[model samples]
Each structure stands twice: as structure tokens, then as C-alpha cells.
Target: MSQTKLTPPGPKGNFLLGNLQEFQSNPLKFLLNLRKEYGDFVQFRLGPFQKFYFINDPELIKEVLVTKQKSFIKSEDIQTLKTVVGEGLLTSEKEFHRRQRKLIQPSFKRSNILSYGEDMINTTLNYIFKWKNGEERLISEDMLNITLGIISKTMFNMEFKEGADVIGEPMEAVMKLGIKRMRKIVKLPLWVPTKQNRKLKKAIHALDDVLNEIIKKRRACNEKHEDLLGVLMDAKDETDDTHMSDKQLKDELMTIFLAGHETTANALTWTLYLLATHPEVDTKLFDELNNVVGSSLPKPEHFSRLLYTQNIVWEALRLYPPAYVIGREVDEDVVIGDYSLKKGDTVMISQYVMHRDETYFKDPTKFVPERFENDFMKTLPTYAFFPFGGGPRVCIGNHFALMEIVLVLACIVQQYQVTLPDDHHDVKPQPLITLRPKHGISLLIKDR
Candidate 1:
């Protein structure tokens, strides 16, 4: 192998900032434009030192995430995420990640996920039942609240009677701060006592307080439990039969606390927004729900039968995946396609960009649930439609998320007709740690 450097073509930025200003302005558009102007394997600099390779080709993405994964690791952004989530599954590396994932995998098993369906439906009904007919509501907030309630009940077997903001608020602050840290060229240590650092510390402390209390009470109970938390508590490494320590448990719980609800909430929020804007798709979804559920609440058994509903969810995720982009850093010099990426170079694969690529999806910008009606997925490359990502580090809760999205969408759309307010124009994606509505989606709710 030659120790030769072959960099892909990209924008020639100013000597100081590189592409930082453009990226900071709008990351989604910047990446999309990168693909449009520079083709699949594009390289760009953030500041003077940070080199990023944007991979749009499915095969190259497959190489980075699956085949040559050992040559790479989670990107610098995930490192910043460690401040909040600790060394949980999302942020852990190599063997520890494998071990943690293996231990946590069982909790999302089909049987365990099926058991969570009732809680999903009931939780959605509980929150939506409060919406007065003919009243306007921020559907994004509603989705967040309902999904938070569902996660609490299903993961902890505890009902949040007050509201979801208990966890939602702190989590929001932590995520915003985390993104802020990611964007900064010079990141101060968490103990630096700057205003941002202080806010992050305060938010993290609030989360730690909540999570520590949950673990404390659960451990005090001293009985076998069946929820996700219980499963994690009881999970043992088969090699050594070692159980996770309290800190380890708290980290995993925090990961789930954020991943479990926030992503699903955003997915549902976008799904409803899509449904409201696309009345034809909305009508088809309602028809499917009526035929399959028919005034009865959605159950786990109905999951498989609701094809169109599932398509609608899939389509929404394709258009507005909460985890909009995936990033990895090269561990060694590696050749992906024609480019030889050196160690420490960052690779970005954006679902937001790839999902809208004209190559995979026809009329890529349109909302077409029917596009998935046939075996459309089979026609595309494995990495082409990766909303949950692919390879070893793919989201653990993919099944739980899809099922929750379908059941919740079914329960809500079946009972209520969701429409945008007369003055409402559009909701832009915020592109935080998770893709959220920049302006919370406002919808007019009415009885079916």
C-alpha cells in the first residue's frame, strides 16, 4: 500500500474559517449542496485542522459503517454527547459497545416490544383525550408528551400524571447545549464555568438526579422486574456473569431516556405533520386504520396488518428522520472508492441528504407513501434508506420505534382528524441532536 494522499474535491473556503460559516448556517442544506456540487465522495474542512469526507454513495457508506467499520469509530460529535449520556451504547466503543449492546438487545426483542404496545396505545389516548375538539395545539409538544408518557410507563412501569416536561425540559437543554458544543471551534471543558457550561452542568445534574432516583428506588424494590429498565438491571454479561454497575445502569437509562422518547416523538410529530399536509395520504391512512382497527384501540396483533399505516410512518421517517445524519471518524488510512481517507478524518452520511437523493427515491421531494406499497425496499441498496442506520451500531430501538410510531399514529389518526391551522405555512426541521420541528408544529384537532 502506498502512503499517498488522494483527497476528494470540495469547496475552497477562506484561510481561517474553511466551510464552518456555511455549515453553521444550515448543515442540512450544506451537505445536500456538497453532494450536488462535489459528487459522492466529497471532502471539506471545518476549521483549519478538521477534515470531513461526505459519503453519498451507498457502497462507500456500506464500507464505512459495515465492512470496514473497525477502521473507524464514532465521530467527534458523539464524543461531545458523552458528557450527557456517559459511556452508554450510543457513545461507547469497540468491546464495551458490543457487550452493552448484547446485554441490552434482549429488552427490544419481539416479545418484549410486543408487550409494550398496550402502553403505547393507552398513553397516546390518555394525552390526546385532553385535546378539546376545534382547539389548536402544538402537535410537536403533544407528541413529545405522549411519547414521554409511553416510555415512562413501558420502560419504568411508572405513569407520569403531571406531564412529560419533567424529563423533556432538561433533556432539551442538554441536547441544545450538546449541539452548541459540537459547533464551537474551541470547546471549553465542562468545569470551565462559562454560561453555556454552567447551563449544561445544571441540565445534566437535573437529569442525573431523576435517573439516580429511579435506579435507587428500583434497586430498593429488590425483585425481578419485567420492564426495559428491569431487563437492563437483570442483564448479565454471559462471559463473566457480571451485572452492570449503578453508574453503568444510569448511563444506559439516560441513553434510553433520550433515545427512547425524543426520537419517537420527533418521528410521530413529522408523521402527523405530513399527514396534515398531504390529505390524500391522510385519507388512505385513516381508511387503513378504520378497516383494520375499526373503532377498536390498536393492539399488537394489528401491527402486521396495518400496511399503509406502516408505509406512512416509513415515508415520514424517510423524509424527516430524527437521526438525520450519521458521523464516523477514520481510525486509519483507508481507501473508500477512489479516495484515500487518512486517519482522524471525519465521514458524514446524512439520511436527510441520501433520502432525498434522486437516484434512490423517484421524485425525491414528494410525499408518497404508496412508493413503499410494493417490495420497493428490495429494489434499493441496503444503505440507501437507512433511517435507523445500518451495520453493528444501528439503533437498538428500531423495532420498538417502528411499532410505537405505527400504533400511536393509528390510535391518534383513527380518533381525531389532524389538520394544520389556517395560517400555518410550514414547519422547518431544527436539526438538533435529533431532527425536531424548528417551530413546533401547530395543528387544529377535531373529532373524527
Candidate 2:
């Protein structure tokens, strides 16, 4: 394989250790500023070893995400996630990934996700019941509990409140550790007795215990529930394999609970915050809701009818994509647009940057849900608006995630009115394994 060297970067820190230190201090700011300086494809080094070519170009992004997908693989950073998430669809490789996706795809079908609508509405309503008129609550944490409950109930058919406290704690702990691990890739091996490593080990074991217990209880039952767990348990691979092992089921369960739950929660939380800050956009969303599903809990089909509401979710994701950056490593030299990408090169495409690029979106800084409804989205390239990613490896839960977000948003809109606290500052984003709100959104809710 020939090496295709990229254009010289603006500057470098050292021959071996490049911009790793600067990139670590502030990833979002660093990427944004780098875009300004380097156009769309900027070259930089990660730590002492890896070379990166940041491609914010939508066409080039599409080339990697769709056209030449097989030439690249999930970057090492995503492999680190397997430490916490295990070898589910997100972490598995090649044929294993294909098999897992085939076995699990049916579980996220429209009918199954729609069946979970009642669970979403009920879980959200339960949370709303706890909100007092004058209280200021951390909206992110609140949504976290609601979505976690919804995912727990809908996926495993477990009584969410029964396992919420136990499962939720370890999940959060592991997420924090995953973040710390990403920031600094220490030289210590996994077995070392470091605080983060110990916590990671404990957190993984705790989650595995919870999942195993759930699987055993389900297996012991006479009747089967038609949720994600049952679907995956019953699903067969293309080879007519019915033997989905307990460990396989456990990993898939962990992946769904982690990916399907918190991501939707973050999206909905950000949507609410965006609504509170932009009253006019809120009014338009309300009008759409009133005209579409007034006073009634939103059904799955109503999701398509709530066009403006869907737009709000899209725009929110555009602004604060839960998965901020996607990374892939090239296995061979390739030409993407005008640039030559070398093998062993790590590349990233930012939904954060592309969504904000003035070239693609008009007034990209403004909150405009209607922008998505136009012919623009129809004509847009594959990578232009990949909130759930694109191509064969696209998030299998795309439909499920969208449905969960829309239903939860509608449920909240119907039952209560919410706003940012009086003294609440504008929210900033922290780009991590997920794009999280820097200062959690604080909200005051009143029953509608």
C-alpha cells in the first residue's frame, strides 16, 4: 500500500507528539478553530504515534461513511468503549458485527418501537408528577431517569423502578470512566491497580451481574413478553441459528440500554433547552402539536404528523449531536475529493461542524427546525445529515431512537410546560464520547 501524504498542517507541537495536548484541553473549540484554519481537511497527529486528517467535507465524509466503508474500520477510540459496552453490535467487528446486527435488527422494527410508546408516555408522566411548580430541577438528570426507565421497561419488560436505582448507578459510573479514559490513554495495562481501572472493572462486573440476573429471570418465565429482549432472545441468525447465548444477549442488552437510552435522553433534554431559549420556535412546535395531536398522548404514527416537532429534534441534534464526532481508520491510500488519505490515518467527521457550516445550512447558528423539511434534506448527500450515522453500519436503532425522542417530547409537551430557570446561563457543550451539555440544563416546569 502506498502512502499518500496529506497537505502540511498549519503548525505542529513536536515531531512525535503533535497536537494531542491542545486537542485534549478543548476538543470542540480545537476542532472548530482547526476548521477555520485548515479548510475542511486538516492534518494533525494524535499523541506520539497516530496521524489524523480531519475531514469536515460532506462529500469526503460520505466517501468514507458510505462508498469506501469496507476500506476503513472503527477507530481504536471506539474499541476503548468496548471495555464498558462489551462486544455488542457497536463494538463487534466484521462478520461478528454482521451477525449481531442481523440477529438484533428485528427488535428495533417500527412495530416493536411503537409498542414501546405507551411505556415512554407512562414513564415520562411519572417523572412529571414529581416536578413541583416552583422547583428547579436538572433537566438532563431528569430525562436520564425517564429514558432509562423507558428503555429498561420497553427493552427487557422489567419494572423500571425495581431496577432503576441499581442498574442506573453503575451505568453512570462507567460512562464517567469512559470519558476519563478517552482524555488520557495512559501506558498502564488493564490489570493495573489504578483507581480508574478498578472502577472500570467494578462497573463492568456490576452491569454484567444486573444483565445476567435479568436474563435468568426471563428464561425461567413460562410466558414471553414481546419486547426487545424477547425479540433478540428469540431471533435467529441467517444460518438458522437459534442459539443466542446468554453472554451475547447480555452484551446486546447492555448496548441497547446504553446507546438507545442516554442518547435519546440527551437529545430530548437539548430539545427542551432549545425550546425554552427560542420561544418563537417553541410556539411553532406547540402549534404543530396542537393541530396534530391535541390533548392526546402522541402515538407512533403521529410522529410523522408532528413535522415541526421532528424538525426541532433534528435541529437540536444538529446543534448538539449526542455522538459529536465519528472516527474511522484508513486501511489503504485513497483519494477523497481533492485530498489523498493514507492508510493507518485516523479521520474524523464532525456532525457538530457540518451542521453549523454556512455552506450547507443558512444561518447555521440559528435554531430553525423548518430547515430540515425543505427539499434541501432530500437533495443532501448521505453524510450531510447523519445524526445516526450512514451506510451499512448505520445505527440500527435510528428508527427506535427517533420514535423514542418524538414520543417523549410529545408526552412532555402535552402534560407540562417547561422553561430554563430565571438565572440559568446559556448552555455550552462538552465533546466527549458523547456531546453533553457543559452546564446541565436547569428547568422550571408547570402542569399544562
- Best-performing candidate as measured by TM-score: 1
lDDT of 2 by residue, 1-448 (tens): 4455557465476777788778888888888888988787788887787888888877788888888887788887887778778798888877888878887877777776787777777777777776777677889988888888888788766676764876777778777777678666663556898987888888878878888988899899979778778888888876875658999898888877778777888898899998878888877877888889977767767887888888888889988899888898887777776668778888888888777888878898898888888755887766767899887788888987887788888877776678887788878887766787877788888776
Off by over 4 Å in 1: 1-5, 162-173
C-alpha local distance difference test of each model? 0.88, 0.80
lDDT of 1 by residue, 375-415 (tens): 89999999899999999999999999999999989888888
* Residue pairs with backbone atoms closer than 3 Å in model 1 (clashes): none
Each candidate's TM vs. the true structure? 0.96, 0.94
For residue 147, give model 2's deviation from the true position in Å: 0.9
Off by over 4 Å in 2: 1-10, 332-335, 338-342
Model 1 gets an lDDT of 0.88
Candidate 2, residue 238: Cα displacement in angstroms equals 2.9
